[model samples]
Target: MISFLRKIRQKLLSQNRVTQYLAYAIGEIFLVVIGILIALQINTWNQQRIENNEELEILLGLKDEFENNLEELNFSITINTKVTEACVQLTQLIRSNSIANDSDLLDDLLVRIGTFNSFDAQTGVSSEIVNSGKLTLLKNDALRTRIINWLTLLIDQEEDILFRSDNYTMNMMPFLMKHFPLANGELTKKLPFDKKKYLQNYQEKSPFKFNIAKEEYLEFENQIWHHKHNNDYVSINELNLKDFLKITLQMIEEELNKKK
Candidate 1:
C-alpha cells in the first residue's frame, strides 16, 4: 500500500500539474489520518474487552465470599441472641431470689452467659480488590461505593465483637469462677467420660467449693447486665452487616447478569 501511494505521488509530481497534485496530496493525508484513527479505536475496544472480563471474574469471586460471610454472620447472631436471653433470665431469677430453686436452670444459664460467637468475615477477594487497586475495574458506581463502605462496616462490627469477647473473658468468667462451681455448669455432659463420674471427680478434687446460697447475687446480676448490653450491641451490628451483605450480593448479581 505504501509503495502504491508513493508511485502515485511521484507520477503527480512529474506531471507538473500543481493544482491536481495538491488536491491528491490533501486526499492522501485525509485517508492516512482516517486509517490511524480506526487503528486507535480498535485498540481501545480490545483493551476495554479485556478489562470487562477481569471485572466479571472479580465480581463472581466476591459473590461467593460474601455469601459465605453472610451465612456465618447469621449463625453468630443466633448464638449471641441465645446468650443475651440467658443473661436476661439469670437477672430475673436473681432479682426474684428464686435462683436456688432451680439448680439445673442456673447451671445452664451460667454456661450460656459465658458463651459467645465472633463474626469472622471472609474478606480475601474484597481486600485484594481494594488494596491492589482493582476496585476501579468495577464500572458500577453504586457497587464500588458499597464495597468501600463494607470495609468500614466490618471495622465497626469487629469493635463490637471485641468488646463482647473481652467482657466474657475478663468480667463474666472471673465472676462465675468466684461465685459458682464450674463443674455445675453441666459442661461435663459433653466430655468423653461418663457425666456422673466426671462430676464426682470434679467435686472431690476441686479446691474451691462454691456455695451459691452464701454468694451475693447483686454483684453477679450487675455482671450479667453488662454482658447482656455487650451482646445486644454485637447483635445489632451483625444484623446491619447482614443487610449490607445482602445488598452487596444483589448488586453483584445484577452486574453478573449484565455481563451475560
Candidate 2:
C-alpha cells in the first residue's frame, strides 16, 4: 500500500499536475485517517467484549457463591433458632419465681446452656467469596464497587447475626460445669447453670438471668425480665434478617444486571 501511494505521487510529480496531486494527496490522507479510526473502533469493541465475558464469568461464580450463602444462612438460622429456644427455656425456668430455689431445674437449665460452641464453624458461600477476594473481581467497575459495598455489609451482618443470636460460646451459652471453690478461695470460671442479639431480631437482651447458686436469683429474674420485656426474640430476628438479607441480595442482583 505504501509503494502504491509513492507510485501515484511520482506520476503526479512527473506530469507536474500540482493541483490534481494535492487533491489526491488530501484524499489519500483522509482515507488513511478513516482506516485508522475504523481499526481503533474495532479494537475498542473487542476489548469491551473480552471485559464483559470476564464479568459474566464472575457473575456465574458469584451466583453460585450466593446460592451457597443462602443455604448456609438457612442452616445458620436453624441452629440459632434452636439455641435461642434453649435460651428461652432457661429464661422460663428462671422466670418462675417458684423455681428460684430449685437446684434440679437450675441444673437442667445449666446443662442445656452448657452445650454451646462458636458458630464460626458454620461455612457459607458468601464467606467463601469474601475470603477468596473474588467479590472484588467483578468487572463492571461501578458494579464491582457496589458488590464490594453490599458484600461487606452482608458479611458484617452475618457476623453480627452470630454474635447477637447465639452468644453461645463465651458470651451466650451456660457453662453448667461447676467451678468448685478453689483452694485460694477464688470462684470457678464455670456457669454453675448460669449464662447470658441483633443482626436479624436480637433485642440486645441478656438471654439468661439465673445462676444456680446466686443469692439473688429471684430478684435477678424479675429485674432482667422487666428490662428485657421488649425483647421479642422471634419477631426481632425475623424482621432484621428479612430486611437485611433482602436488601443485600437485591443489591447484588441489581449490580449483576447492570453488566453489559
What is the lDDT of every predicted structure here? 0.84, 0.52
- Candidate 2 ranges with C-alpha deviation above 4 Å: 97-145, 154-175, 179-245, 251-260
Clashing pairs in 1: none
lDDT of 2 by residue, 82-116 (tens): 44554566577666755546544444444433333
User: Which stretches of model 1 miss by more than 4 angstroms?
Assistant: 187-209, 213-215
After best superposition, candidate 2 residue 42: deviation in angstroms? 0.8
Minimal lDDT window, size 10, model 2: 180-189
lDDT of 1: 0.84
Q: Each prediction's Cα RMSD?
A: 4.2, 9.9
> How far is 15's C-alpha from truth in model 1 (Å)?
1.0
Give me the candidate number with maximum lDDT: 1
